[model samples]
Structure formats: structure tokens, C-alpha cells
Target: MANTTSAKKAVRKIARRTAVNKSRRSRVRNFVRKVEEAIASGDKAAAETAFRAAQPELMRAATKGVLHRNTASRKVSRLAQRVKAVGA
Candidate 1:
């Protein structure tokens, strides 16, 4: 459908970016899931550790434009709260 050479190149670039973004999003979800699973298992130490790992990943995703900054911060805040509650 793209008749122009530039448009064709743009379509290719978009496809590559889409793949990269999808991978990044999936990675973020996997990190979050790890934290949640640790929390659900009621292992405070593991939950805290997982939260530590996930927090950076979330922020990195935001930095990479995979997520909004506020969304990442909100997720970090909520997960931190849950991690704290796990110890209590």
C-alpha cells in the first residue's frame, strides 16, 4: 500500500520498532509477575527482592518509551506498598 520509497522504509522501521516494543513490554510484565508471585507466596524476603528487581525494570521501560513515567512510578509505588505489607 505504501507507494513511496520513504513510506516503505518507514513501514519497515515501524515493524522493527513494534517487535522491540513488544519484547520490552513482555519483559516488564514478566518482571511484575515475578514480584506478584513472590508476594502471593507470602515470602517477604523474596517479595522484597523481586520488588527491587522489578522497580528498575519498570523505570527502564518508561525510559525506553515502553511505558509512561507516571505509570511506571505508580506501579513501583503500589508494589512497594504491597512489599511493605508483606512484612507486616
Candidate 2:
């Protein structure tokens, strides 16, 4: 238990931040899933569009510290590759 008033406030802030981060992470995952589903469906145009939509979201996640820079880069690379493969 947080005995100090400041400590309690810090815990509340942490809880709020956790919810915000979780929402952001979930949103990113949904965007990635959309790209993957488009790829799996073999819709080249849809996959490309989904990839385009996902790129900025992934980059934003990195910028917001929701994801590591390399992780976001790797995800973008992989998604782009899948998009290209389908579009080919």
C-alpha cells in the first residue's frame, strides 16, 4: 500500500498510463492484423492499402515509446515485404 499521498497519486497516474499504453498497443495490433489478413486473402491491392495505413501507425507507436524503434522498423519491413509479395 502507498502510505504517502504523493505515492498514491503516482500509483494512480501509473494506472492511467497503463490503460493508455494498452489501448495504443491494441490499436497497433489491430492495424497489423488488418495487413496480415489482407495478405492472407491474397488481395494485392488491399494488402498494399493496408500496409500503407499500417506504416504510419507503427511509426507512431515507436515515436510514442509504445514500441521500440527497431521493433517498429522490423514490423514495417516485414509488412512491406508481405505486401510486395502479394502485389508481385
Candidate 3:
């Protein structure tokens, strides 16, 4: 129900951005899940590997605006601590 062409274009852009953001968010969540699963399984090496893999994804989510930087850092920090404890 956008009367102006600019508004119509904004709606279209938002729709496209939403789809992209959804995919990014899903991918980040998947990485986080993988790390958590590895930790739950008590595989220290696997957990470390998964954490390593997830770090970049989480940071990317923050850098790309899908996640807040502090939130992403907190998640990474917690995940790293968990991995360290498991590895220790």
C-alpha cells in the first residue's frame, strides 16, 4: 500500500534485505549450535574446532549488522571459555 514510488522501492529493498538477513542469521545460529553440540558431546578437540569455525561467523554477523558487536563478543567469549574448560 505504498503510494509513492520511493516507498515501493524501499519495501522491495527491505524484503530483499530481510531474506538475506534471515539466511545470515540462520548460518550464524548453525555455527553456534555446532559449537554447543560439540561441547555437549564432551569432545574437547571437536569443540575447539567448532568454536574456531564459529568465531568468524559470529564476528561477520556483527560486522554485517545482523548482530550487535557486544553481543557477538559476549557469545564468542563464552563459547571460547567453554571450549577452554573442556580442553583443559
Candidate 4:
């Protein structure tokens, strides 16, 4: 119900932003999932590699405003710990 022209334009912008954010969020989740799957498979080297890939994706998501900085950092820290534990 955007009656004003500016309001309509704003709605359109929001829709586009929503789609982009959705894709970004999905990409982040997929990256995290890859790391988790590698960890679950008990392949230390593969898990480490996946973690390396995921860490940057998580931070990039935060930089793009898809995730909070602390949240991203926390996830990276926890995943790193899990990856480390895999070898031990």
C-alpha cells in the first residue's frame, strides 16, 4: 500500500535488498554447513580447509551487514575450536 511515489520506490528498493540479503545469508549458511560436514566426517585436513574457507565468508557476511561482527567472530571461534578438536 505504497501510495506515494517515493514510498513505492522505497518498497522496490527494500525488495531488492531483501533478495540480496537472502542470497548472502544462504551462502553463509552453505559455507558453514560445508565446514560442519567436513568436521562430522572426521577428516581433520578437510575440516581445516573448509574452516579456512568459511571463516572469510562469515566475516564477509558481517562486513556486508548480513551478520553481526561479534556473531561472525563467535562462529569462527567456535568452528575453529571444533576443527582443532577434530585432530585430538
Candidate 5:
């Protein structure tokens, strides 16, 4: 479908970017899931630890344009709340 040489190169670049973004998204989800699982299991320490690890990953994804800034902030805020609640 990409008839022009430049269009073909652009398609290749898009494919590469898509793969990278997909991997980043999946990594972020795993980090979030770890925190959520820790919270659900009622392990305050583990939840806090997981939240600490996930916070930077979430922000990194946002900075790299894998996620929106507000979306990452909201996720971090909600996870922190849940982690706090786990302690109470």
C-alpha cells in the first residue's frame, strides 16, 4: 500500500514505534497489576513497595508519550490512596 519510498520508510518506522509502545504499555500494566494485587491481598508493606516501584514506571511511560500526564497522575494518586487504605 505504501507506493512511495518515503511512505514505505514511514510505515516501517511506525511499525517499530508501535512495537515499542506496546511493550511499554504492557510493562506499565504489569507494574500497576503488582500494586493492585498487593493491595487486594491486604499486604500493606508489599503494596507500598509495589506502588513505589510503579510510580516511576508510570511517570516514565507518560513522559515517553505512552500515556497521558493526567492519566498517569490519576493512576498514581488512586494507587497511593489504595495503598494508604491498606494500612488502615
Candidate 6:
């Protein structure tokens, strides 16, 4: 539906960006899942380690515009809380 040349190019760029963003989002999810799985298995050390790995990934996704900053901060805070609770 892009009739103009510029419009066509814009569409192409959007497609490429979408693919990249999708990949980034999936990667973030996998990192979060690792922490969740570790928590579910009740391994405090493993959960802590996974959380450590996930925290930066979450923030990085935010920095890359894949996630909102507040959303990433909230997720990190909640995950850290859960990881800490694993020891209690």
C-alpha cells in the first residue's frame, strides 16, 4: 500500500526494526523466565544468580526502547524481592 518511494522505504525500515525489536523482546522474556524457573524450583542461589543475569538485560532492553523504564524497574524490583524471599 505504500505508493511513494519514500513510503516504501519507510515500510521496509519498519519491518526491519520490528524484527529487531521482536528479537530483543523475546530475549528479555527468556531472561525473566530463567529467574522465574529458578524461583519456582526453590533454589535461592540459582534464583539469585538468574536475577542478577536478568536485571541488566531488563535495563538494557529499556535503554534500547524495547521496554519502558518504569516497567523494567518494577520488574527488577519485584524479581529482586522474590529472590531475596527465597532465602527467608
Q: Which candidate number would show the highest lDDT if scored against the true structure?
A: 5
User: For model 1, what is the error of residue 64's alpha carbon versus the real structure, in angstroms, after optimal superposition?
Assistant: 0.8
- Candidate 1: tens digits of C-alpha lDDT, residues 1-88: 8999999999999999999999999999999999999999999999999999999999999999999999999999999999899978
Backbone clashes in model 2? 0
TM-score of 1: 0.98
Q: What is the lDDT of candidate 3?
A: 0.96
Q: Cα lDDT of model 2 overall? A: 0.94
Q: Which residue pairs collide in model 5, if any? A: none
Candidate 6 lDDT score at position 83? 94
> Candidate 3 lDDT, tens digit per residue, 17-68?
9999999999999999999999999999899899999999999999999999
Higher-scoring candidate on TM-score, 2 or 5: 5
What does candidate 5 score on TM?
Answer: 0.99
Which ranges of candidate 6 are over 4 A from the true structure? none
lDDT, candidate 5, 1-88, per-residue tens = 9999999999999999999999999999999999999999999999999999999999999999999999999999999998999978
- Superior by lDDT: candidate 3 or candidate 4: 4
Alpha-carbon error at 29 in model 1, in Å?
0.3
lDDT score for residue 40 of model 2 = 97
Model 1 segments more than 4 A misplaced? none
- Tell me each candidate's TM-score: 0.98, 0.96, 0.97, 0.98, 0.99, 0.98
Residue 44's lDDT in candidate 6:
97
Pairs of colliding residues, candidate 6: none
Q: How far out, in Å, is residue 61 in model 4? A: 0.5
Question: Which of 3 and 4 is ahead in TM-score?
Answer: 4
